[model samples]
Target: MPTAVYAGTPVTVTEEGFYLDPDQWREDMAPEIARDAGIDVLTDRHWQVIMHMRKEFAGKGTGPTVRALGRTSGVSIKELYLLFPKGPAKLAARIAGIPKPRGCI
Candidate 1:
């Protein structure tokens, strides 16, 4: 595990940089996390996916996959790619401060 600082707070993260504890996540840390994940800015559309991912994680104990996000996040798969160019579900989960979505690789 590694520790990352965002918004002046230290948070534990995995070797790949995903947060180790989702409870340590704060919405205020999102922008910095997004930048670290190669997303320069978080638009409203980005937030939609982030919030939906968090909601799904809270309900299901895991982040949604790209397919699930496309189907339920109100954002199309094409647009998701456009929004998070590094990788939609992966980067979204990173910025959301949640663990990487299952099957992201």
Candidate 2:
């Protein structure tokens, strides 16, 4: 396990950079993490997906996959790519401070 600072708070993460403890996450950390994932800004659409990801993770114990996100996030698969780009689910999960969705890779 390793720690990185997000929004000036230290957070433990895995070797792949996924947070080790989702409970340690803070809403304020989202912007910085999203920036690191190459998203310059988190629009309302972005927050919609982020909130869905967090809710899914809290209830299911794991983040949603890209396919699942497309169906449930109210954002289309094409739009998901447009928003998160390059690995939508993985990047969104990172920004949402949840573990990478199962079966992403």
TM-score of each: 0.94, 0.94
lDDT for position 14 in model 2:
83
Encode model 2's per-residue lDDT on 44-103: one tens digit a residue.
999999999999999999899899999999999999999999888899999888987887
- The C-alpha lDDT values of all candidates are 0.90, 0.91
Q: What C-alpha RMSD separates each model from the true structure?
A: 1.7, 1.5
List, residue by residue over 10-92, the lDDT tens digit for candidate 1. 99998888997999999999999988877788889999999999999999988988889889999999999999985788888
Instruction: Give lDDT for model 2.
Output: 0.91
Lowest summed lDDT window (length 10), candidate 1: 96-105
Off by more than 4 A, model 2: none
